[model samples]
Target: MKTPGHIRAVSRRTVLKGAAAAAALQLAAPFIIKARGETPLRIGMVDPLTGAYAAVAQNEVMGARLAVQQVNANGGILGRPIELLVEDSANDVGTGVQKARKLIDRDQVTFLIGDVNSGVAQAIAQVTNEKKVLHIVSGGHTDTITGSDCKWNVYRVCNTTSMEANAVADLLFTKYGKKWHFITPDYAYGHTLQKAALADLQKLGGTMTGNELTPLGTTDFSAYLIKARAANPDVLLVLPQGSDMVNCLKQVAQFGIGKQMHVAGLQQELESLEAMPPEARVGIWMFEWYWKQPGVSGVDKFVAEIRKVNNGKVPTARHWFGYTSVHTLAAIANKEKSLDAKKLAEALGGFELADDVKLQPNKCYYRKGDHQLMTSAFVGEALSQPAGDPEDLFRVDRVVAGDKTAPPEAATGCKLQWPT
Candidate 1:
């Protein structure tokens, strides 16, 4: 556990030098703003093009595209259309760094949105700070990403592992009568989330039987599954995403081990559920940002339009995450009333979102305390397919409010607070 003083909400240090602190201001910078003859709001989204995470990368690209269309249809950001440039980073750290440089130096994007891998996001954050470009991350969640590597130039809009812990921490332990074990990827994000979840579980009177950290692309999980089943824990937290998740489920089902323990965690896309056989995925639970929970205003239309765009097939959760982040970014720039990165960042601190369909506009604001959005996370269970449904998949089971699950200032492990 982080020491009581380790997760300080008050920013203990300053890392952001002002935009004016940058030495070179281009002559075309003035023309880049579009709304009122300011710089055009040039944004870039860097994602994987060819990798295990390709499907998710494509989903992010599509979502950003949708937001650009929506923003333009509604009269673009400020006035000019949000000119977005997308580069394929292929989930490689070096590739993401190179692409970020190209986006900032050659393409002159005012802000950026992606780089799916945490390592890449960290590298890109470094470059963005040196060049003074605002990088809005929709992917990449590690405590240290916002902890030690944090900078004012970088902001995360996705549910951090912090939020996921609050969403699922005591859920299985208390409600489902589950004592837990963790199977996590051997990286910072996975380990961090696992730690937080375990801490939360411990706080709720649960104990972890054991945990196993596996390599990134390990395909065969027979050994791990056997060990987990042998432990006989009531529930398992499987936190791998992409192909690794698909393979783990297949192997878990092949051995019929999940019957011994319930499986639940944060899932990447709906496609992961579809990737498995019926008996394998039944009753598995997960959390996402955009499932259509009951009475969730505007979700039906948002899902409908998304299905329409995808040839009547439901869009993946990743697609909605990317789409929503783009809208959030555009809305912040809109609130800023200019394309200035600093202004947008300043306004992001006070920005709020109502829903997926932009209805009932609320005074939603990003807590300057930690740069986390004051929003909600949707938790869902795998549902049994009805007789005539198009597919057997998961639907949202509950909505967890951001504030409800929000960790206090002492939990983020962040040292810097935004300017109030």
Candidate 2:
């Protein structure tokens, strides 16, 4: 006979081998009492660990792992060691829901964080909300996470499509050109970003020459490249992400289209860019975080530590998302003096954290109306001439304030509900 919410727990130090090993570790007692007389603070994380987005996902998990170690080293949250139980979402909506339920109902995780795919994130959100568990969207970028589909217990750390579009439109239009063409993934996320980008660019006297809707995980973009080249737009905005992004850009360069037209996009992940050769990496794009920005307190220390752990490989924005998500939740839990979902929700509303980035008035917060994290958006250009270090790929040119980047609260259509 096994008890409910019983999953074998592993310490922060153990490396989870695979899904089976991770599941095997979840035997009974999801919330394990340590020999130190303090119960563990469990956090369940689900993401696409082995799929098109696996490289980016790996960095995201590393970020969370670093944060967990940092939190535990500092006496843990509220004097209890934090235990992280991870599940591979596999980039499938059904798998995401199953994992979410397992974490909530069986593992009894204190809260949840996840999901790279917007669709998968939404599916997991439903489960966490039903279980009354607080979840932070650490990587998902679809507008619905903080829009009409928002839930009371859910929060988003990543910028919405509108946020990225609004933030970078003017900069890109002015710097690149006013005439644009799009290479978008034929999916909800791509459609949302493409629509937002077009709308924002149009406001600045920009015109869309063409938009090529490519299926996700497309390998050969020769046909799309031919269409984009013929359209002869001033800027080619590649809107697909993850492997789609890597593939399209590489093919674009190979097709010699990049040489004729300026290349750009809505968002970029350093991990994704690292996968491509320097010759293949070209374009100006939106970046949520950069490891080498100047005058930021604790950034150098973070970069140094991550580099040490990853054999001198620098951390990326995805890593920061995971690191920030865990630390922010733990901080809020400590501040509210409890991990109750309702209390945490109330505390997060209008809560402010002073970030050292120095770009956004040194502060970021969750909007009371939408639970969207108000933070700066950065524009980075892949350097044409490498200054030697392969990691020194992008040169961050501008950092837009969050207030200036995100749309007005009334326009977002998020109606948050609080407990009685």
Candidate 3:
């Protein structure tokens, strides 16, 4: 019924109102986003939190939690809070792979950390590599993690068996005798560790009295001890780790084997030493980290912070491994200002940890070619009695730099291939 001009006017008014509403919504968009908050960056961790490595694995988690707290308190990665989700690997490879897939596919984690057991670590690496997730091997020490089997997306914070062996080989040969026997674990970790040690011993003109391969979780070491004692080696290298090490060392002390021959090992953990009796703690070994470094910068603060969460127990190398792994992701991502896996991986090629994070006297950095952290080894002997502090169970004889202990990257056989 209206005139044509009137109808046109009404349509123009409606159009203007709609345009005004659209402008208002555009103005409100940023505030709505701000109110909704940013999505938190998720990190997945897998470890043997329930099995033989539970004690050490839990310590690693504790360190990781502390790192997350510290990172959020400061500004977090890419200005978003970090959420760490941990899964128990149960010290089994099949279970570890399943958990890794769950973290990658179901939980949608941006970064991955895990596995005190080397076999489980390698299995998890396959998943991480396929998914293109950034992964840091927190405690697994098998050489292949950073050697022949190394992946572009994977980096290791712990020392390889070859590094541990090289750290103490000369000292063991000079101080102890040249004749040696081994109580090695029957997994990839023990196999490579024994091989590396044997190579070092042969190079030093040492003789192997005998070598015994003990299966993982074997509680009865009596038969192995009998064979070792019969051989009458100058040194007995007890190489089993976690609960196995505790059982073997307890039996060794019970048999009074330390009194007959020198007891030594390449890599030893404070978690194992604390679980053992004073007599069973007898050993010359290398600690990837030690808490009682007198003159080292940042060591005191790190120890104090860990004690709050650790029931006043000191931080072990496993703890440092977890802390460094989390910090590695945050530090590199924040520095590069991007969460892209390839970009971050390239940034971390030769990244040096900060002084506070390193906590050792020597320089600590990742080797560019292999992505293995060149952290200092705390070479020392276990103390029967507390040196000063109740938790001080080691007497650090030397702080050897990792560069000196680790072989050349070319020698490691690591060839990193990036996704095309």
Candidate 4:
């Protein structure tokens, strides 16, 4: 565990320095694509390319593409060109599982990455582990992915539900009052996030005024908005994400409840912010990464590259997850000189992330205990006024080291079943 004092929230300047260092490491990486007359190493990526989370998933795929391009340019991994095969899970668990099998069994991909939906990610985890193929999830953030349901072949590059919850809970309570009402989704992702948020709130002497659980793919939030208005809590914690998140915030404005209480969420992404109207995008939430925040040495270069490919649009944290997961996987394979699932998993067990990745100043790493990538946690507040840059949606407010946000290993109940 990090010492109690290790996780102090920092200012933008300090965070920028950290970002610069990380980006510097990235810029220094060699990009030579030498051919060694070897067969290409294939990696299968599964994501919801056309659904509620399509925007975020598409950005993730773009990130992965950039990583592959960079690795191939760097003489390919171990002189073998990397080939990526993408499958659309459409945010469904059964479909995701089928796609996973196709990728592993037919495509014969040695590695796998992706899935925005927690349920789909969990299902894919089971498939990948059974096949003994190393799967690195880029966008899935369920606690169980790194907790009780963790598999040796499955690893995550995103923050867990608990980390997301604790990152902003204390700050929200401190800035706004403790009485809270929740607009939670009715699914594995929503339940886990809500539970984590409530636990953190309670720890900080906060109380839950009410909760309205809405079904997934909900279009109309009228009934929930009415109930939330009645509850009139200090903070309205909306936990639905992607299109649902955009819809909920829009409804909050339509209901005129934005002025009545402080609005917040367990997580927020660049896609949702772009989809949201300026009037509806108010409030504070946890952000996995923000492109404009300077710290890593090569972040500006990344942002420029992404913007060029994305038609001048800034890349979100989803993109970072995709890019980092692929690059990290490739780096490990090169270091170990093997793609054996067990060897790859072991290589990543305690691997520390370089400073050029837009996280905290402290070195981040994947905890061997749970296979969770521990990085810095940031809280962002959506701006109500025009910030000139359309991508300038949020003003980053706080930076907390991952060590402080992550729960202690003993508390996670992750029993790794590595092959003996």
**Where is the poorest 10-residue window by lDDT in model 4?**
1-10
Q: How well does candidate 4 match the true structure in TM-score terms?
A: 0.90
Specify the poorest-scoring 10-residue window by lDDT in model 3: 1-10
TM-score of 1: 0.83
Error of 4 at 376 (Å): 1.5
lDDT to native, each model: 0.65, 0.78, 0.85, 0.81
TM-score of each predicted structure versus truth:
0.83, 0.90, 0.91, 0.90
In order of TM-score, best first, we have 3, 4, 2, 1
Off by over 4 Å in 2: 1-35, 354-361
lDDT of 2 by residue, 71-91 (tens): 676767787877777888888
**Model 3: runs farther than 4 Å from truth?**
1-36
Which candidate, 1 or 4, has the higher TM-score? 4
The candidate that wins on lDDT is: 3
What lDDT score is found at residue 293 in candidate 4?
Answer: 66
Tens digits of per-residue lDDT for model 4 on 194-246? 99999999999989988899987889999998988898899999999989999
CA error at residue 147 for candidate 2, angstroms: 1.1
